[model samples]
Target: MAHYKAADSKREQFRRYLEKSGVLDTLTKALLLTSKDVVLVALYEEPEKPNSALDFLKHHLGASAPENPEIEALRLEVAEMKEKYEAVLEENKKLKTKLAQYEPPQEEKRDE
Candidate 1:
């Protein structure tokens, strides 16, 4: 069914996102740390629950998770760059419109 396929596709994308974010590896390591004080098998068993998984990981793994101050700085830089890029694009559009106003229109050619 199309619905099932779409759900499967979303699952695949989420799996890839988790893998790329290193969440999968961290969760695995945490789960393997069953010999330690924390019991992280809940992460594997209750992943279907809607909650802050990253927050959970950060709490248990401390600074080992992907998020940090350096990443936060990079994210802010990216957002600033995007804002500047949009502003430049708007200026470019306005300049092009002004230039078009000063130029004469060209006649279209006929195929006769």
Candidate 2:
């Protein structure tokens, strides 16, 4: 019975130490519910810490989670624009090649 009591006391002491060290603060936990970018930055900047608000935000929000529908729509529009741009670039290359083939080469003059 005494051995069990000693073990329980040790566990309680550890829990108190964690809380006092701000290892489980509310803001840190709330950040977890917000975004992952914050978490990644924290991880890179504070490699030694076991807990980071940034990581909590990232873990809860996920790194790839889009914040708004408008942003997502804009991303899709940008991708479509890039595809169109690539097609135009290909066409331009072909047109330039054809033009070069049709043009006559200039003759170089020799110095007397």
Candidate topping lDDT? 1
* Model 1 stretches astray by more than 4 angstroms: 1-38, 41-58, 61-67, 108-112
Q: What is the C-alpha RMSD of each candidate to the true structure, in Å?
A: 13.8, 10.7
Candidate 1 C-alpha lDDT tens digits along 13-64:
6667566667677667664465323524444445573255565566565645
Candidates' C-alpha lDDT: 0.67, 0.62
Candidate 2, residues 1-112, lDDT tens digits: the string is: 9999997896676456445655446335655543434544554355354554434444555654656989989999999999999999999999999998886655422322
lDDT of 2: 0.62
In angstroms, give how far residue 17 of model 2 lies from its true place: 14
**Scored by Cα lDDT, where does model 1 land?**
0.67
